[model samples]
Target chain A: MLTAILIMTGIAIVLGAALGYASIRFKVAGDPLVEKIDAILPQTQCGQCGYPGCKPYAQAISNGEADINQCPPGGEEGIRKLADLLGREVKPLSEEHGTEKPKSVARIDEQVCIGCTLCIQACPVDAIVGAAKQMHTVVAPLCTGCELCVAPCPVDCISMAPLAETVETWKWKYPVHELRSAA
Target chain B: MISRLFNFRGGVKPESHKTESSGTPIDQAPLPKRLVIPLRQSIRSTARCLVEPGQKVLKGEHIGQGEGSLGTGVHASTSGTVVEIAPYPMAHASGLETLSVVIAPDGEDRWIDRVPFDYRKVSREEALGWLRSCGIHGMGGAGFPTHVKLGSGTGIDTLVINGAECEPWITCDDRLMRERAAGVLSGAMILRELIGARRVLVGIEDNKPDAIERMRAAASTIGDDVAVVAVPTLYPAGGEKQLIRVLTGIEIPQGKFGTDFGVQCFNVGTAHAVHRAIHFGEPLLSRIVTLTGNVAHPGNHEVLLGTQVAELLALAGPKADTDRYIMGGPMMGIELQSLGVPVTATTNCIIAASPTLFPPPPPEQPCIRCGECARACPADLQPFELYWFSRAKNFGKAQEYHLFDCIECGCCAYVCPSHIPLVDYFRFSKGEIWARERERTASDQARARFEFRNFRQEREKAEKAAKLAAKAAETRAKLPEAAATAAGTAAAAVAAEPAASPEDLKKALVAAALARAKQQKAAVTPKNTDSLSAETQAEIAAIDARREKRNTQDADKTP
Candidate 1:
């Protein structure tokens, strides 16, 4: 009984020391789980999740302050992915944030734009380019379809145009199989 | 010579309707009223448009310049004036519009200055660039740029020319070999010289006896040790990997090039185009398209690249009940969106499909685990499992089963007991996977940009703070000097009184500095006021008085 106790005590102390050293040596500087969650969230920066950006939202989720179903741009597909990652039950999207819509980009009406630079300032991704009192244009590829620039346009010149499907962007649809029962 | 041949597992033998179109001689199609040539001809990159609207172009003039080594040049099929450069419906599975150049033919049939390419005089890289300029792509319906395949020509020992023509009702290659055997041989010889290969083997399906005899006779005349061997007639035998396996007995692993196996494969039609490009200095402006399926005069015609499918089908006398048109073979062809779509470089066969000829597929049924698809898959993959995984939307599981290796040959679908469209599911799964990958990349890029913007904003704030701090430091540095001067001047005044302490000297210095600031403020004059009228000056004075009263009131409240 004495030898067993001594051996057990010695093993526990060695293992504890090794674990303590490993924790310090392999210590991550920041919450890496937040980074992984941020990778899963679509970086639209639309604040639909009630956070300032995707990173802040990820931090909130990591802290258990935000729900996973709040992001509408990520849609149901995103909620499912988050649920899979967090080992939680999949939930429907919240009703208050926004409904999922087709992907679109902002287009500026060059004629009506007064060159006030308001929309440019409102753009979160810096996808708009122009000088003060000059016509502003949106780089379609860079625009994240956040709808943040629409409200700031004084002349209501900025419109969210749904992206048109071309040969390059076409995708094959899922095949639907209808099965008839033997009964 | 009887060369030993290898066989690929899991292939189905459907009834071949080659005799319907292969019996007729090749005919030259007349110039149409308009030709709409798409800029995105090859698979890699789209050619940049060189000719604008209203520009007159010769028959062989390069209207679209190839982008890079992978891009092939596009030429005007006939001398004409470019009517418009706009988007038109393309012959694709998606039936979407692509950027095309519309030309109204003038019927002049004029030619540009043709000069033969002397490959012996120039470097291999230069010759390959010339080939890219000649618009030579694999005409076997893949439309892969030939120069890209030939560029990596080192370590290649055998050049296999594919004449299998395995797909049913596609006999353009068969007719080409039977009629233009010499040209194909010459192109093979050119490829051999360019790649420095020791042997050339032409693999034709045993179904095409006449083509084999003619190619053998032509090879004998060339005396270049070219071997013309016949392989078993099987569906998809003409596939690049399949033909290579049959000719050289080498299985190219997935994601690897055939050149890595000391062999390179080229279609017979591609070989003929190479001969034309090098010997006659002609670009790939036209191709021999097979017109068959529910037509009165089924034959092969060398149609120009941009001719409308309707016009070409009219020559073949399509029946009145024809409902649709298919672009490639019946096994792997896509149903054309409209008859108005133009024939592109990859168009080898156009089938006027009718209800009687090609009926609708039966309604899909649930899988019973028959395993017939596995027996019929040419790539030796399990099709039933892929179908289930794809049905369940489990892309990860499908990928684990090597879903990408399934070459959508329709063999599994043709043999499925449940009439399930297996290829469609595979296509959907592959597309979903690609789209997901693209989204991930896009999200990663957006994240990087967002982070960079945040960093930049933080840097700008820090820079502004530093500038303000530096200015405050400068002011503080100058204040000590001003205070010392005031203390020095007041030292004489303090000496008359009793000995003053250091605290008293500091107080006197601050008071003198405040008095100097007040004097300086009073001495300053406002510009643009000297030339103003008396009334304007009086108004400005009233405004200043109101501002001063408000400032005193604000200070009183705060204190």
Candidate 2:
């Protein structure tokens, strides 16, 4: 019985070592998924997703507390792409986050003269680079076009202006109106 | 044990919670005054809104038309005066707006017309056409246009009718299969006609013996058109790939469609929808919605389209402060934020009654050294490995373990003694990956646009230089002999400069011309609001916005 016990211990040691070695040797490095999810976010750096920023949201997505449909800025296409990646059923954007709006930038009217600077403080992307209690102007170029500043405006001076169509921003959509003028 | 050899690994094992409200007959909900019929309920594109707002729309009247071959028409759920044709809150978590034609229902629920055809005489194409015209789509959770499915999946040899209602608390399909066997068979015939497969297999789970028996009887009556196969009861066995495998002993390769195996599957309820579409030219308006879970009355009810979920809950006698509202089955269902979400074609069941339906989410804890989750995983993955990788946010290792194949069935979480919420981890990883990808794509697009814009600006500069040179040459050419001679002598001397080549001389002339052009270009700008076209100013603002946030984090991470 003693001999048997000794042999069992020897066998157990061998098996455990084999498993331990495999664990170390086969240890794959770096998850490619976080990168992919981070790529899909709007990157507006807005906490509208209930996270500190887009990267955190991407991490949260990897964690599953947030739904793929929460990025209203990314719209349906973004949700669909996320669904494809995660293999989750692609439902419409989660309504709690808000709906898809026309791409807009906040334009603060200087003449309104309130100078409350509330909108500036609320800018998630630091799009409003201005002094406190002074006439604040929106740095349109820095804005992610998130429109988060509109809500915080005290006197309602901030208005969302639909970004203009330009050659740079425009891509030829797959010609959805193919039948037009042909018939 | 034999089945275990082939099934995929790593499924979830969520509590069925079916007992909250099952084993009861369906109760009727009080009809609302206005039934808001959305034009785009099915997976297909929204049907054309045929009826203008404020017109009297009769029940079953074709109010919306299916677009081309990939659409289903919209029908009025009940006869009433059309109240509005405007955007309203849709049955989505987004609370997004959709075009809805609201009808204030009168006392009399009436259908406008019923165009019935002989089922026997209808050709396959004709039948498919009728199905499209009638506006039928898969009532299964996917809501794929039904006619599109019937349109041949090339080389298909088997038609698997999904009766494996495995999700707990959802019995609408079971009740429909048991009660309307003949209609289902007729619908199957239409499908058989749609795709001339070697054989049609009807797979009902053993749990539903009555449904199985009824379906078998229906098959016998239909003769050799369809074959009845009873698969062992298993959660998510109704999944097209899973059901197909149970019937035909085949597995769908990952990242491939079921058609690769020469098989097609349809929900039993979707078949009935097909039958309604083919027999009576009826658009898919109403469907058998399972009213169960935490409710007093638990069964199947044929609810109209665009029915408010709140009213449906009232019908079920939902408890005040019911904890959860799940659309479809608990395993794959979504949690709804509000009861105001309208019911659509894809809404098969609404679990809206129990505190037990979705108890407070399980307290998450570190996984113990237990292999229960591995044993329970249907996909045969070492979910423990996935769990470690997922928890660490090491998506690479998780993917190596076939993370994408984990169906998020909650089997691992259910079986886990530690209750790790493993699915949530996997979900989070996937979402992060997607978010990253979107950022990458937008950056790539931005980069390409920037490059193209720079190239265009360069070309414009070159063109202006050429124009200025041409103007100088023309002015020189028009000069009189003595003046022209003087000019030529000066030009020749400049050209003859020892340091200057012919190319240099040409470049110098071009530079002088370009300087002039630059001044002109600057001068040409509209000084005031009136001078600036609204279109031009808008363009300038957009360009300015583009320059501000040029670098995106996603672009830096993804290739």
Candidate 3:
């Protein structure tokens, strides 16, 4: 009986030591999953989610400290993608922050500008180009319509304008009813 | 000669209403007062409009130039003055708007400088450039650029000229072959020489015996290298892959072009255009369009590129009770939203749907999984499964079933007991998938830019901190002996951070956190409101009073 007990104890210790060594040897170095989640995000850096930027929100999501629905700029489609990735149930976008709007870019009125650099500092994507006491202009293509620069502009020159769709940017709209109207 | 032919997996043979329109010879459609030519006519590319409003353009003069390597040129069909350059209805299923140049024809069918070249004497590249400049593209349903198609015919063994005219009630190609067989055959020979092909086969459906006889006689005059063979009558047998398979007994693999198998196919009308561009120095300004169904006269007419369909229908004598107008054949056509849409190079047939002739399809019913659609699918895909997944909006599942392989032929729809509109579902699924892919690409770009911006910000912060530390060290080095001691401690505090211990690192982190918290607290303080108006000052006082009252009320409630 003692020998059987001793064999059982020896087996447990051997397995335990093997598992412990394997755990240390095969430890994951970096969180690739968080990187993937960050890539899926729209990356507007709007700060509407109360996070400083998209990366901080991604980290919070990975750590389970923030819900996927908090991103207003990302909207419902973004939530659906996050749900698919994290294996969670899809939820409606959190309405307390904002709602999804058509894509827009911030346009700064050059004529009304008082050469202040506050918007440049407020921009997360560094899309605005200017120096201190110099008129700033928003690079149209690079601006993410995050609306972060609007609040810091004391003159209120920055306004969101919907992106004009050209033929190159036009996408096929679905035919809702097969027969629309007869000739 | 290809003695034995091959068969595709599945196809349905619809009733051929060819004799309705094939009864007479081709007619020249009269020019309309105004021609609204869309800037984009080719499927592969959308040309950029070169002419502005109020500009006078001669016949065959370029109005739009190819914007990309794969695009075709757009020319003025006749001498005209540009009236407007704006968006108009396009010949698409969605009837969406596209930019067009509306021209008021000057009533003079004058020609630009016609420069026909001996294709044999000219280099292949030169010939292709001429064709591209002439706005020559396949008159087949897809409207692929002829130069692009010809460019892929290198080292081709068999060049198949598709004269099948398989769809019912569309006899444009048939009439073209019957009337201009010599031109078509000459074009085929030119194409064969250009591509350096050893064998040329002209495949025509057996139903059009007249076209077959004419094409055979024409091919006989050309060497034994060209053979005109009649293929079996099938719904989509004229499809590039299907015709290639039927003629050469070779099946192009899925998601591959016919050229990949050392075989290339061009439409009979496209061949005629090639011949005209090389021999007669004529640019492709017009094509044979069939106006049929519920019209007094159902026949072929050589309609100019920018003429409105309403004008063409007026000549064809449309019945007063016509219900609708379809652009192509009944199987693979789009219903016209308005007759004002112009007839581009791709408008082969316009069927006037009437209550007595063509009726609306019955409402859709649920699928019982009978699998008739699967059997009728020409691409050999399971249509029922595609239907289920697409209806459920499970794009991944639909993709797994190879949803894009569907040819949108409406063969399954014709045979479906449920009248499922299977092609519509497939198109919707494909569009949704493309939209998602575009969204993903945009998101990826945004992410990269955002990440780069963040990295730049971090680098700038580190550089600033390093510069500040170096400046402090430099100032300490120049300080006096009494002050140098104090400055030396400050320099040491900056330099000592390089080799910190675990305890020191923790303390440093705590100190940094405290400093950041204090900085944030300081940043929250309001400032720079010294010169406020009386109205603003009263508003601030009212807000302060409300806050004080809320605090007192909260205190009372707690007690």
Candidate 4:
């Protein structure tokens, strides 16, 4: 009986050492869960989730400091995706954060722009290009519709214009079944 | 000679209503008063518009030059003055407007100087480039640039000319082969010579006997080894992959080209266009359009590229009860929003849809797992599962079921007992997946830019700090040297004062710099508002308060 017990202990100690060595050798730097969560989050960098950016918000979520429903730019769909990823129940988007709106890009009224670079400094994605005391223009394709630039504009020249549907951008809508609806 | 043919998977045999339009010979459509030519005629990059508003252009003038290798040139159909370059309704299902060059015809169908080149005299690359400049695209509804397909002809062994006009009520190809079989054969021979293919096979549906007979006669006259084989009459037999399979017994997998299988397929109409461009030095300015369905005279007419659909219908004597127009054929066609849309390079047929002739589809019923769609799918994909996944917005699951393999063929929908628009669901799923992918790419780009901006700002701050530190060290070094020099020249008491510790001197410098910055800030005052009146100041205060309130409201509204 003593021999069996000693043999079992020996096996346990060896396995423990192997696992300990593995933990050190294959140690992953930074939280991979945060990177995954950040990927799922629409990288709008709008800070609508009460965080500085998407990465910080992802870190907060992984730390259990922020709720999955706090992201308004991601909308209810995003909440569902996060819930699925984290194995949590899907919840409605939090109203205190904001409401979901159609994707848009910021447009600056060049005539009204007072040659101030305040909007350029305020852009999160650096989509606005200008120098000090120079008229600024927003690169429409890059602007994440963050609205961060609009408030900082001294002349209030910036406006969010919803993307227009063209032939290339047109999408086929979901098919509605009348018979199923009646049933 | 009887060539061994291969059969494809599930397909449906719909009633062919082609007899109505196939009886008459092809006729030339009258020149439209104004032609609205869209620059994006091919499936790839759009052509760059060369003519501006009010510019005079002769017939066959290069109005839009091809942008890239995949792009094909666009030509003026008739002598006209460019009226305007603006967005006009296109012959697309979306009914969206595209940039179009509108030209008013000058009643003179003047031709540009035509210099027909002998392909035999020039290098193969030069010949292909000539075809690109001629704007010869596949007239088989895909509008793929002919040059790109011919350029990738290194490993191609068999060239299959698709004459299988299988879509119901569309006989443009059938009419073309019957009337201009020699031209089609000549073009095929040229293509064979260019690609250096050993054998040429022409696959025509058995339903169109006249086209087969005429093509065979033309092949014998040319004394070339072009086999005109009439395969079984099957719907979608004219499909590029399907026709390729029927001719060469090769199944090209999804996301792969037919050249990988040592075969290349070209439409019969495309072959004719190639002939006209190479032999006659003519660009693809007109195509044989089948004008049928709810029209008094249902026949085929060689219509110009930018002819308005309404004007083409009028020539066919569209019935008064005609309610709508459908482009292409019944199986794979889009209901045009308005007849005012211009005919593009891909516009092969225009069916005047009416209530009595073509009734609306019955209300869609839930799928009972009947598997009829699966039985009718030519691509052999599971349509029912795709429909369910797409409806649930589970794009990942839909993709898992090989959703992209679906060619948007209406066979599944055509056979579905529930009358579900299966193709529409597939299209919706594909569009959503593409759109999501595009959004992801854009977001990735934005994230990179944001991170780079942050990195740059941090770098700038570090650079400034380093410069300041270097300046302080230089000052410190100079002070010690000066103090040593003073010790040698004057009394030792000056150097014996402990030299005022470097820490103390650095602290004093920082304090002095801060004090100077504060003085500068105090000196800078408001220039315009310095001498403002009391009323103006009050008004400015009120405006500031209002602005503050509005900003908060705006922030609240932002998502």
Which one is best on lDDT? 1
- Cα lDDT tens digits for candidate 1, B307-361: 9998899889999998888999988999998777898877999998899888988
Structural RMSD, model 2: 18.9
Mind giving the per-residue lDDT tens digits that candidate 1 earns over A29-110? 9998898899899899889889988999999999999999999989999999899989999999999988998889999998
How much of the true A–B contact set does each candidate keep? Answer: 0.59, 0.00, 0.35, 0.78
The TM-score of candidate 3 is: 0.82
Clash counts for all predictions: 0, 45, 0, 0
**Order of candidate numbers by lDDT, starting with the best:** 1, 4, 3, 2
Model 2 residue-pair collision total: 45
Best by DockQ: 4
Candidate 4 runs further than 4 Å off:
A1-21, A177-183, B42-44, B481-496, B502-559
Between the candidate structures 1 and 2, which one is better when assessed by lDDT? Answer: 1
Q: What is the lDDT of residue B452 in candidate 1?
A: 82
Please identify model 1 stretches exceeding 4 Å from their true place: A1-17, A177-183, B482-559
> What lDDT would each prediction earn against the true structure?
0.88, 0.72, 0.86, 0.87
Per-residue accuracy of model 4 over B176-221 as CA lDDT, tens digit each: 9999999999899889988989788999999999999999998887
Clashing pairs in 4: none
Which stretches of candidate 2 lie above 4 Å from their native place? A1-183, B1-30, B39-52, B62-72, B85-99, B117-133, B151-153, B356-358, B388-401, B481-559
Predicted structure 4: lDDT: 0.87
Question: Lowest summed lDDT over 10 consecutive residues: which window, candidate 1 chain B?
Answer: B491-500
